[model samples]
Target: MDTEEKSNQLELETALNNQTLYWQANLKLLVKLLVVWFAVSFGCGIILVDWLDQFTIAGFKLGFWFAQQGAIYVFVALIFVYARQMKILDRQFDVGDDDSNQEPQS
Candidate 1:
């Protein structure tokens, strides 16, 4: 019932809200990246291969290239993209382990 206690409770509530929002954002980013990964790896590589095969690239069928190589490249690129995005997300959430700039604890 004291003013200090009420202020502390409000600060805790705000922090919890911010943490929840950060997690929600992180999950949404993860889902979106997974969807793109699935679409490239499975959709283009398998389900739509027949349609894509009608085109040719460097003496290889587009569908075959996608099924064999293009998807792998995309997956690798996605890994780097995810890492970069997560770094930014970590900064946004005040997480991760770059501690040189932090104040020393007593």
Candidate 2:
């Protein structure tokens, strides 16, 4: 292949590789967050209610806290955390707000 075409191909390959890596990282982050979510929601709320109820925060029981407000708060926090982390990941992978990072073939 000619120099210009070969250069273009190389650039495309680099961006695609970075994109794949970015997705994998994002998936890992999502899985971690979900696991934590489940732990707080189900593990605390249902599985360990008797143990958690011993320490009441405010008037509500601890397990009730996990089921009612804690899980919701944690979910909101997770949303923002995921967004912030992905933005950092984007920059780390050289996938910033630049057209060159997009697929070159289309």
Candidate 3:
């Protein structure tokens, strides 16, 4: 192969590797957040409800709070967390909302 062809092939391989790494990082973050949501919503709300009920929060049982309100609140918080984390990840991967890389429109 010519030098230019070899150079293009190397660039392609590098881009593919970077894409794979970015995807793996994204999935890792997703799995971690999901596990936290599952533990709060299912583990605290249902599986350990009886145990958690022994505790109180603002005149409500902890388990009931998880089932009724806490889980929803946590999920919302997780949404923001995901957004912020993804923003950081995007910056890290040089992938999103980067106006500096764009040409000015006429």
Candidate 4:
């Protein structure tokens, strides 16, 4: 093949591979969000608060915090954190869109 033809083929292959990578990164981030969601909302919020309250992190009340504000703050922080982490993950996969910082739709 001519050099130009080879270059075009290579570019096409790269684009298709990039799309596959984007979807993989998207899937991974989605799974991570779900697990963290369950852990915070269900684990801390409902199942383990009483037992967790037996101990405190920095003397902050555990169960009350879960019921009141702590879990919410963690959830909000996770949103930003996941946004940041997803950017890294997208770059790592070499599939980041121009807006890589934006998290993918679940």
Query: Which structure among the candidates has the greatest lDDT?
Result: 3
- Lowest summed-lDDT stretch of 10 residues in model 2? 97-106
lDDT of each: 0.84, 0.85, 0.88, 0.77
Error of 1 at 9 (Å): 1.1
Taking the tens digit of each residue's C-alpha lDDT, what string does model 3 give over 3-39?
A: 9999999977876787688889999999999999999
My TM-score estimates for the predictions, one after another, are 0.86, 0.78, 0.88, 0.63
Q: Rank the candidates by lDDT, best first.
A: 3, 2, 1, 4
TM-score of 4: 0.63
* Model 2 stretches astray by more than 4 angstroms: 96-105
Q: For residues 1-106, what per-residue lDDT tens digits would candidate 4 score against the true structure?
A: 6999999999788877877877887788889887988887788878988987887766666876786777788789888988898777767765557674443532
The model with the greater lDDT, 2 or 3, is: 3
Regarding TM-score, does 3 or 4 come out ahead?
3
The window of 10 residues in a row where model 1 has the poorest summed lDDT is 97-106
Q: Which residue pairs does candidate 2 place in steric collision? A: none
TM-score of 1: 0.86
| TM-score of candidate 3 against the unseen true structure | 0.88
The candidates, ranked best first by TM-score, are: 3, 1, 2, 4
- List model 1 lDDT by residue over 1-106, tens digit each: 6999999999778777877887898898899889989988799989999999999999989989999999999999888988898878767766545684342222
TM-score winner:
3
